[model samples]
Target: MNLTLAIAIIAVAAGVIAAAMRRVPIGQVHSLYRRGQPLRLLEPGTHWVVPGLDRIGHRIDLGGQVLRFEQPQADSHELRGTVYWQVLEPERAEATIDEAPQLIRCGALAALGESPLAAGDRRDLGSRMKQALNGALRERGLMITRVELEIA
Candidate 1:
């Protein structure tokens, strides 16, 4: 009975240790939470957390992302484009990482809607949209690197 109890305790300890150790991969950041509250951002490496008391809230990719959107204009035409962006600050972006794509899409549609559309102005429009998106996304720790609009 004593030997069985010892083995059981050792197995439980191993399980707890395994649960406490977290390994974050390269080019990714994890948001640590304690009892449903935000704690901190965990960078790429091995980390330890209190078993059952702490959890990984969000796993944010520190890599580039692409958002493709299509918006219809009053002229019955459509504005379609791909936006290239990435997370510059995971700490500030943790809250909006999941909504980044939707935010970019909405911002792009609004910017395009405000501009006068013309075949000769597509290039200028792309640049303007990039600027507008970056302006809105900067505070969220995201940046628009490039905006590619399809000429149609």
Candidate 2:
């Protein structure tokens, strides 16, 4: 009985170790940074990760992702916007940004930053934001599918 228990424990441990070492999947992309440089891209299929040496990062969808930015109103203006983007190069996508969401946020903000609109101009601001996002994403090898404004 004791021998059987020991064998079971060993089996479980081995399984866990194997699972840990296996590559992450391709649908999910992991950003690898080494010495503050985008080092490698992990795909969805599976990847061997150095248990301690290489840091395993969050899984970002290589496929299209949708982002919504709340329209900020300072006085009497209404603001609301959305952006849809997809990764053109999985490797570049992973390597380019520290965090996928941060990249998205930054893109949205950068797009917004380039605009000359004031706080109250929701429509103009949204249009400028879309243009800006597309321009910025082009640099990162990402494609912006669409930008839409919500009525609410």
How does each model score on TM-score?
Answer: 0.92, 0.61
Q: What C-alpha lDDT values do all the predictions have?
A: 0.90, 0.65
Over the stretch 1-152, how does candidate 1's per-residue lDDT look in tens digits?
Answer: 99999999999999999999999999999999998999999999999999989999999988898889887766777778999999999989999988998999999988887444788788998999999999999999999999998745
Q: Give per-residue lDDT, candidate 2, residue 10.
A: 100
The segments of candidate 2 whose C-alpha lies over 4 angstroms from its true place after superposition are 1-20, 32-39, 73-75, 95-128
Using TM-score as the measure, the top candidate is: 1
Error of 2 at 126 (Å): 5.2
Window of ten residues with lowest summed lDDT in model 2: 70-79
Whole-structure CA lDDT of model 1? 0.90
Q: Quote the RMSD, in angstroms, for model 1.
A: 1.6
